[model samples]
Target chain A: MSMHIMSAYDEELKYLTRRISEMGGLAEQMVAESVRALVNSDLALAQKVISDDTVLDDAERQIGEKAIVTIAKRQPVAADLREIMGSIRIASDLERVGDLGKNTAKRVIAVAGSGIPRKLARGLEHLAELALVQLKEVLDVYASRSPEKANSIRERDEEIDAIYTSLFRELLTYMMEDPRNITPCTHLLFCAKNIERIGDHATNIAETIYYMATGAQPEGERPKDDNTSTLGSVND
Target chain B: MNIMSEAAVEKALDQKMNTVPYKMIGKDVSVYYGEKRALFDVNLNIRENTVTALIGPSGCGKSTFLRTLNRMNDTIENCRVTGKITLDTDDIYDPTIDVVELRARVGMVFQKPNPFPKSIYDNVSYGPRIHGLARTKADFDEIVETSLQKAGLWNEVKDRLQEPGTGLSGGQQQRLCIARAVAVSPEVILMDEPCSALDPIATAKVEELIHELRTNFTIVIVTHSMQQAARVSQRTAMFHLGNLVEENDTDKMFTNPDDQRTQDYIMGRFG
Candidate 1:
């Protein structure tokens, strides 16, 4: 790409970062209210979060269009070119994250009358908070170009993993203790897993931001032989 | 060649130039062969920054139209023009316009490499020195280097800037011509069938240079090769019988043109 075009791509990257930050704020709110709706059985707030998904979808569409126009007009190349393009990929992930939050909120409405047991509800709330914190941290790293912040998010993702493992074992133990608890316990386990997946997606966004700022794919141990390795694992 | 034909040519010579975007504009633009109308009534405005390729069968005024931008036609005998062809927003055809000054602001790389009988450094520096565009010798050196860099010729000639430009291969020589053109910082650069005399490799080199230069200078190229015109020019203006039949974006004009005549010409159904 020409120098003029690369600078234009930089402008597009800044615009995309702003849009993502706005979407991040919305996603954070959705997660908070979604857990609250679960704890308090507030079907209205849960429904509102589900219905507001169209806002995130609209933001995704706008960011996608901006990236497409940047590609068409500026013809970015190398790493500078990749940043504008990476926004589209990251925006798609953010949109999916929104969908996942909406799905969790919809689950709240599913069990509106009979919410999950209080103990399982606490685990879900804890998982949601851990995921939200990691997501917020990853976003901060992305916006500030801080590798230290990104590394901290990567470490904090392990906290979500620990919560997921505890929630999984707790649900399994509950099912083993009383077969009557199987249905709700399984639903709660899936909800916690959903939150865990949100943390994973946040990590993916962090890695992408690292690539955008530093032009290096996040350094880690090379994975074992997998023919599709270059394609990267989805939502990670 | 007869009286009726002479009067028709005279009438064509009388029409005023229309300077409009997407059209090559020339005013009272005239060319002569001891009193003959190569182009008449040639008032035209070639649209801004488009690759307006001049294509027609030989001696059909396409090449003459391309040359008039740099006043390359001025070298010919009895070639008299009484109007203007402004590029972007500047009137280039005014009589008071210095041909040297005009040539600097509107550069030309000819059908052949035609590098001056000098080193590659001299070949590029010739324009800057003649125009006095550089303030110091270092400034002149930087211009030569940057121009060559922009032309994609720097790497090949960097080790041998002092070597005669004529010693380079055909493609290198043409790139040197391009470098020479860029050194003067022209807003528009005219190419007159630049690849005609080069081998396929050299032709490709010139075409690549044209693509690269498009970002900087509005290029108007004359090409006998129809495919070359289709490949290089964003907008193609096909001239026939001393008239611009169609001027459209390259893809559209090649695939589907407004005039049946242009469609025929592009498809090789007619010239």
Candidate 2:
């Protein structure tokens, strides 16, 4: 870690880091709670996760403002500038993760009365577990300034995408076999996609952490196992 | 037809004079005052028609390096400079080389606006008059007007040509000094904290002038303000503890310095 001679400037940067950490923790909890709500068919917890998203949004706004103010006042260069810019970028990615969690929670509410299949819900839980681990590891990378840990998390994104792809096919198979499973399985597909997108946000944060630590973008294309194009549902 | 090897082609390209040719080259340059060494062996290349900024903490040999360009350190008693500094192909430190002519080719501005106690027109015309650059009254008038215009002070002081240069505002006085430097049509302009005494608006004006001046002359500036260096310079060199730490493109130096000492200095980490 680097420090400025001005203790107040250092304190402000520390506060900014703390705020981002808080937002990361909140985003992680929301993803877990949203997935837990879906598995247990608990509407109350899903609603709570959706309502708590505003806290992460507020934290992101605070970080953005502080970073801009610090940039304007300190005119920081090199690592200090990178640290402030990295905080702003990480907060933005975390806010989007919160939104994805909130979207998953809303899907949980949509499928509350319809009984979800144990095998399908279990698959999604596993997917969420992978995504949460990615988020947690990337956050740890940010806090510790470890490009190696960040690279490991980035490499694991393909695993989350592979799980998401397999889960997509399983849900599609279930829907085709029984039209009765269509409504609930479609909702599950969307929730699974939300979790997949959370993994993507985690990967983005990992890339940002790598840049902050090394002052260069991670070389080469990020590994991707997402084969959603085969489903004919990937617009991109 | 003979085929050139890739290495030979690259070597030829490197030797070719491009837009970024070195105007001044310092090789193994070192400075000493009395028995104490103030600067280590420093090698730097100042590109033609580009602004190169030297930045560091107090007594870090940035100013000393700046002085070495025009041999301004010669005024100091018991000061010694070793190694070579060449302007284009000519050795500037050769005993036979006229210091007056050398100073005329490489003019300097100081931290404070030290305009001569003369009228604005006289301040601008002094160099040309001494060098016999103007043959007639009209010629002297033209040199004064052109120099003032280049320094971005013609419009501000056009009507008050006879007014004492010292009576102008701090920023205007600095511009007058710059106009004085330009009067000689120097190949390079060395500014040592030219805007340090000015207010923000004046600093901005001088910075703007520096940008405009780059199209016509090579500029080397020594400044305490990193932002100013970033704003006005294409290349930046960082000095530390009498050693040249690093030099690179201005944007690269500020955003991602290769040297930890440069990073520390620019980041305000104990500089």
Candidate 3:
């Protein structure tokens, strides 16, 4: 609630917070633009999303090094220690989110010449849209330091899983309907899986924020809804 | 508070309370130096074989409370302590109790190395000799050797037992003082900023020695260094403005202290 007595120490921690916010923005942009590239078949936009991922990587590295230096110099305790540790954990998760976005962008090139059917593109769009919302909301939760918002984000994680499970079945059906759909459908399945993983990373960040604010892990395991693992049949 | 974590913490505390016995208990302790009151109604318990740290800013009664443990305050002309302090159910402040014997059982090591100008052997042997802890020369010899060993200084000082204690490095002198305290075979060892005057390496050695000594003795340390308290003590008690703020396990106290005052004080947010 109060600033540390040393102004420079406060400045160091503020720098960490500002860097995390910037990295969050970059990650969100990558997810958004990669999905847009998929819908529009824009090779240039897909390339831009891939290139932007390195920036997130750099931000994560800087945050990690700064966190270590702050620990050595300040020997912070209580909330300060938790805040730094949370920053490291969240940075790492966001970096993985960046990789997922890049992987999805690479899939865009696979399906680009194959001319994805509008219906399949729309389904992938919906899945990406849900994951992006989660990413943005979890970042907002970090900015606001609200456990309520974090819990809400966690509860909504299953929505992405549900959409992904349906998309998995839909892609399978398209491949079965016609052999020509196999090449593009397989790539789309991977893209869908990548988007689903982004949702999982968003939940990871949410859990970190909850711990940062409350100094305690969220009780019980998150109610996982990714039923795709057991979906042996589309009917299931 | 998170409900699950709170439940775990409560359960852990319940188990600790049921299992760990108190080495000393002080109840409703208040101290006065002439007309000036230095301590309020403070109640604290020292757990057996555990290192308990007393921490606070200057003039906050941390040292005063440490002194009260061995009735060191009694040496001050106008100082008067009113409380029930017990060493295993024996009232320490009772009129019939011998202050000298009480001090022997609860030995003290001060901030400065206050070893006498005598040889190192003499310094370590002084307490045991006066307390009649050993009779034969061979017995005193073994006691001196083992005391230094317990203090983690025997390897360095065994060959030079007749050398003057003050001639050793600052850290060695402090360890010598600890060796002297150990010679009395005290039940509880009280250290008041014992490493403040030593270099970092020496300070680290003393800290390491404190950790090792915990298996045998109940120690209460008064320190200005929060890191030292966090490092060496199993439990830590924070004092502020002559009042007991809170005392808890060292891990809990440093990571997530309950009182805001303790948090601010540990984090250097207190003005």
Candidate 4:
């Protein structure tokens, strides 16, 4: 926890931490704004979310490049090496989270002018809220360097999965009840799936934080509850 | 702070069953130069057929520990050592043990290429000649050729076997020293910064040779370069201020060493 003798190395590591935080914050905002764009059918906000994803991609690329240069220059070992590698992995996951948010924003465009049912939007809003909380908490866990908080974050991913599975069922039932609902319902379904995947990316970040902080992967299976796979087809 | 689990997982996944056998064991090993203690109550083990790297900042007793393996410290006046260092079942420092024969079993290569001012062939055959391992001229020729081949220097030096070893390039001289050490067929080879005096290309060749040599001889290397330790050794031990801070698989030592001192030292955050 002391500064590196070559203070420049300490600065590079600090720069990595700061970049990851900035990237995490941007991803979180994109996911949240996309959900808000979906619920209110706000076209401009949805466009802004789509445009903002490129920034996350750029941040990821810059962080990855900087990490490689630092490795070449410092030949860092021990925790410094772990921190660099973790930043690369975490940046990758955050980039995917940004992409998922952009995917959700595209759905907002598909459902923008259409009259989406209030109940359907409500389910998606709840899913997005839960996923955002998970994303926010994992980023905070990474910043705090507390492996203990990472454990609870991973265990709670099952809760997000449970919600997503129920929402999947709900969306299917809505489609079946009215054939006219199929067109708009499919977009909402994709949006819900994207939000669910954002939750999964949050879990991935949590595991990475655990490894980065403690240098050991979290033990045991990661208690996944995404049972949508096991359910019989929509006919069932 | 255990970081071996990931490396262990990879090994388990690969289904590798490399049961490590200890080639040498040091227990309560302490070294003193008259009144100053250089090492304090160290307990460490060297794995058979593996490269064990000893690393620390200067004056941290890494070299002192390396010397204790073959009793190189005994040559220093008033230097006393009290502890058991066993090479197999024999205490290397015991009164009845022959230091000369022990050194042949545990040969060394120094930081600088210190080949004797003799023909390259004699420089390598010198150890075998002294030990009388070769009975005939043909036997000496075979031992010299094989030692050079094993040291990865034969291809460059085969045509000029009688030339003075000092005439070759720095890297070639270092490889010649390695060939000389290999000539004795030592069970354990001790290297004191074996690449410190060579260029990067030469250092790389020596590193590659060290990897190949692990099949035949257990090696203990004392080095100041953390990158070299990370690259060449299977197991790594960190010494700081006369104490062993952490020892672990090289994979873990470079990425996630246990003690704070080990991490700080490796990361150039030494206090």
The Cα local distance difference test for each model comes to 0.74, 0.92, 0.92, 0.91
Judged by DockQ cut-offs, is candidate 2 incorrect, acceptable, medium or high? medium
lDDT of 2 by residue, B1-271 (tens): 9999766875675454235789999999999999999999999999999999999999999999999999999999999999899999999999988999999999999999999998999999999999989889999999999999999999999999999999999999999999999999999999999999999999999999999999999999999999999999989999998999999888779888999889988888874
Please provide TM-scores, in order, for all candidate models, with all chains considered together: 0.48, 0.95, 0.95, 0.95
The most accurate candidate by lDDT is 2
Model 3 / residue A107 / CA error / Å: 0.9
How high is the DockQ of candidate 2? Answer: 0.53
lDDT (Cα, tens digit) per residue for candidate 2, span A1-236: 56788888998899999999999999999999999999998889999999999999999999999999999999988888888999999999999999999999998867887888888889999999999998998888888999888888888899999999999899989989999889889999999999999999999999999998888888778999999776755563
Winner by DockQ: 4
lDDT score at residue B124, model 4, on the 0-100 scale: 95
lDDT at B83, model 2: 88
Q: Which runs of model 1 end up more than 4 angstroms from their true locations?
A: A1-236, B1-24, B27-30, B88-90
- Point out where model 3 deviates above 4 Å: A233-235, B1-18
- Please identify which of the two predictions, 2 or 3, would achieve the higher DockQ against the true structure: 3
The B-chain TM-score of model 3 reads 0.95
For each candidate, report its DockQ versus the true two-chain complex.
0.01, 0.53, 0.57, 0.74
How far does residue A143 in candidate 1 sit from its true spot (Å)?
Answer: 64
User: What is the per-residue lDDT of model 4 for residues B1-271, given as tens digits with 9 covering 90 to 100?
Assistant: 8567766788874343246888999998999999999999889999899999999899999999999999899899999998899999999988999999999999999999999999999999999999999989999999999999999999999999999999999999999999999999999999999999999999999999999999999999999999999999989998988888888888878888878888888889856
Candidate 4 residue pairs in backbone clash: none
Among incorrect, acceptable, medium and high, the docking class of model 1 is incorrect
Off by over 4 Å in 4: A232-236, B1-18
